[model samples]
Target chain A: MPLFSLKKNNVHQTGSGITPIVFSHGFGCDQNMWRFVAPAFEKDFKTVLFDHVGAGGSDLSAYDSVKYGSLDGYADDVVEMGRELDWREVIFVGHSVSAMIGVLASQRAPGMFSKLVLVGPSPRYIDDEGYFGGFTAQQIEELLEGLADNHMGWSAAMAPAIMGNPDRPELAAELTNSFCRTDPAIARAFARTTFMSDNRADLPNVVADTLILQCADDIIASERVGEYVREHIPGSRIVYLKASGHCPNLSAPDEVVRAIRSFV
Target chain B: MKSSGPSVPLSDGGEPNAPAEDLEDLYENAPCGYFSLSSEGLIVKVNQTFCRWTGFSKDELVGRRLRDLLNVGGRIFYETHFAPLLRMQGFFNEVALDVMTAAGEKLPVLANASERRAQNGDVLFTRVTIFPAAERRRYERELADARAAADARNRDLTERWVAEREQGELREQFIAVLGHDLRNPLAAIDAGVRLVLREQPGERIATVARLIQGSTLRMSGLINNLLDFARGRLGGGMAVQLDVSKPLKPTLQQAIDEIRAVVPERVLQMHLEVDVPVAVDHARIAQLFSNLLGNAITHGDPLEPVNVDVATRAGQLTISVANSGPPISPAAMETLFQPFYRGEGKASQQGLGLGLYIASEIAKAHGGRIDVVSHANETCFTFVMPIV
Candidate 1:
């Protein structure tokens, strides 16, 4: 199938700008994660929302392990989506792991994207010597083991912490629902790909104007990780949000919108 | 209070007007845990029953979210599924979760929540009821283990069955090799008999040589049938090497003459007319013709002539064997060409019952077909091959 149909790409044109802002979700969820944030840019930009292969309403048969083993595969999908849709001046908005995917895509097709907005971006999730990427290899292994044994249990336990709204249980509930709806095998494969990936070297190759939105108390992607991303990418700016979780798009959509609006 | 089985009576002496303080006591001491959360999921109010169930004080539980009382997994479930469902559908029911106490002990529970809406249609708060469900969760774990055990057993049984079938196939192929090896010894024995008969022994000794020769021929036929059956079953059907350069009529006639030598008492008739060279496997055709002729002689009436017909027309070669006999029953005809199928007949009149099956398989290997027609007056088996 064509990339547009295979990816379940949905286009909503409401703005006058020649550039289209495309929203790509991270590993654990789908395009629905951008429900609150994508609409904020509809009036000023041509907004695009799509599920990656094997997530949401995408063609699950299109997901081949070899094709999606690395961040490069997802980057290729973004570039192919542009070519299939005949789209230009693309403004890519990527969340979590998708931020590095966008960077890789922009490097491959530099003239395709005009700007990039990265939300809770993490180039390397595993911590190494002299660098703190928030998680240790052992911790991620435990997380993966928990997922393998009882995915529902893992989702229930981690969604609230990830959402950072223990006072408002609805936010945590939304995250868990998203996690449960995904295919378990695909979710496991994507989790390994997202957490194990190290895209630090590819960050300097990005030519697009990039905005990194970092949350205040994101345990998944720490403040140090955000700073690492900003330092590596040339001519990029970082805006810190008061929202105290990983998914500011769901927890605090207003702050995420404000950050993107000021940069664009 | 006098008649109510040692229970205390109402303070107002059966009056409908109970004090608000008394009603508050009933609400706090309810049998199950009861709590309410604001639309934002903050714990607006919780009864004493709920506080005691979770082993937390009122001060610690009141302002916190209901999800905060549960364990990590329960908190995730509350936030992801429970909260979203309450907001969207206005109610959620009987969701299983584990509540963690102050000392980190788990209490399994099933919770039901309903949204409280104001007149303006906005959600004011959510009321949740919790019930213990330890026994049900334990039962579910047992059921899961049982299913896993059954699946493992099924896999083991399937592997054993496959291994047994492979061993059986190896045994059958071994028998086929054994039958093939016996052929050389039998041929040697037949040659020795012929040489001794050439010496012109006395009449009494000559009779023994003739009987030995007859037994050897019969044994050889049985071995050939066994070998063919085994080859067909083990080596993916009978292997036929086609030699298009060979003439079909002469090859078939030669096979007919050999069958005539075997059954000299049966009157044989042949009508061979072939104007063109037909492409075929000559040795396999000879085997097929020999099997068909042998079948007709064994089953046909000795008083009637067994007919052999071969003709080539319109790029097709048709060979048929017809003999007079009782019409084959529908029951017998269905399995007539199947291997090891012996219909009701005299035991003395039986061969291996593999002759027709081998003939059919050989025909198929040459991309040809065999058809049989049985009637009161005649039974005919016809082989049709395209002259490619």
Candidate 2:
């Protein structure tokens, strides 16, 4: 198969520099989530952006339940894309669940990625014995239920009227009909996979120099989780940003860009 | 909740003072709950209705984030979809959420929120309004359940229908194969009987060979009818090759002779008045004539003569067979040409009931039809087709 048809993940390449900087978006959105941050490095680095299998412009038909049931399947795609693009000493910037996905990909292809930038990363989501991953099992189940409700036409029905914000023409143009539209069933499965994953064991196996951009007041991945990630990954350091949400790329893109620039 | 209005001056100038209304009381006691959250999502201020609805006082509700008041599901929604959308669009409307009360009860509500930004476009605070929606949620759940049940029933019915149709096709295919296989053995018996009769043996043996020959001929007709019925039912209709070069009168006579030989006691009269050539499949027409003649012999009065008429006139060819018998019942007439309908109380007949049905199918394939008329005096079946 041709490169684009192989994964059908809507991979886009830009920037003049030769060293590729791949940006993987987190859950709840697609590569459009990196609009504000990814462009900042276009002049200095070769920027690459893509959607996951079931989100945004990615081919939903390529989403196999068994393959995407675990985060490893997503990591395989990342590894395959890296090899297809023929990138060596690559810079990978991942947000939220994609952060862990990047970690897994780095481990699978040992020195393929030279620098790993994990923003609001969480190695595990559910709290285990002697581990405060921030959420309980029951809460994760509730989250799944919430996802079902969101996709059951409740939010979708209201999105059109709400998105007609005349005051923000830029937002209207940037959103292009849907901000974070995803296949309902795929989103539910992806949520279960993301929240139920335990990649703490995989953290120590990272060979590349890693940086964790921990945001303040992030409920999804707490400050403690960031510190735990730093301790596990050898020679990895954490940079605390003043931004207060799980998506600092959207909220505080400048700070995210600055942190990534200094690291890469 | 006192109304505030300026009293209109009466014509006689009686009362002028109006009652004053407190704005704070109206804001606090509104029908819907209202709250304002700081840019960080903390509750900076809340109305009395919201506090009362949640069973929390103003002191207890202050300085807490809005997500803290929501249930686990609502919190996750707020963090993942709600907050990100609000950050991007600056507003969201009619979002369904379940709020956790101080007493641990869940209050389902439809909430709407809009961000308030300063002159420089920096965020100040967000205003939120919520309405209780327990009844609406219950109705939606019931609708979803009904829809799901209907979908499952439709899927089940479609699957069963497909399975039944497949089984029917398979049965017809089996019948076609069986009919084809029965022919070879039947032909062998027919050939053996003919050979035995030609030897001019003893009278007893000659009579037995003739009986065997009649039985084999009847069996062959039954198998041919069965194969035709199977093919027609399995979507390949009766195929006919209309031949205008050969006259059709001889084929009809041959069919009558075969039927007469099978039942020599019954009298059959054939009237052929054909001067023009009729385009028709010879073998198929012969089969049709044989079927009608056989049916007449079995069902007609044994003493009465069965009449077979064939003629070409007025650009049409008509072949009809008539017999004197008891009138066919109205109920049986409705299904007279249907396959496997061997007439009620006539189950003891010596052939499968597919004869008339195959006859009708052959007639239809030739752009023709068979019409039946039954009365106390006589019952007649007419096959008619245009010469063209």
B147, model 2: CA deviation in Å? 1.5
What would the per-residue lDDT of candidate 2 be over residues B169-196, giving only the tens digit for each residue?
Answer: 9989999999999999999999998999
- Quality of candidate 2's docking, in CAPRI categories? acceptable
Regions more than 4 Å wrong, model 1: A1-16, A124-180, A195-201, B1-44, B62-99, B105-255, B260-289, B292-356, B360-388
TM-score of chain A of each: 0.86, 0.94
- Candidate 1, residues A1-264, lDDT tens digits: the string is 454653443333455555688898876557767777888887777788877777766777778888788888888888888887666768899988889999999888868898999998998988898889877787677445434433333334333333432334444454445533556567768778888999989988888999999988666788999999999999999999987656777667888988998988
DockQ of each: 0.05, 0.43
**What TM-score, computed on C-alpha atoms, does each candidate reach?**
0.60, 0.84
Candidate 1: pairs in clash: A156-B76, A172-B79, A172-B80, A173-B79, A173-B80
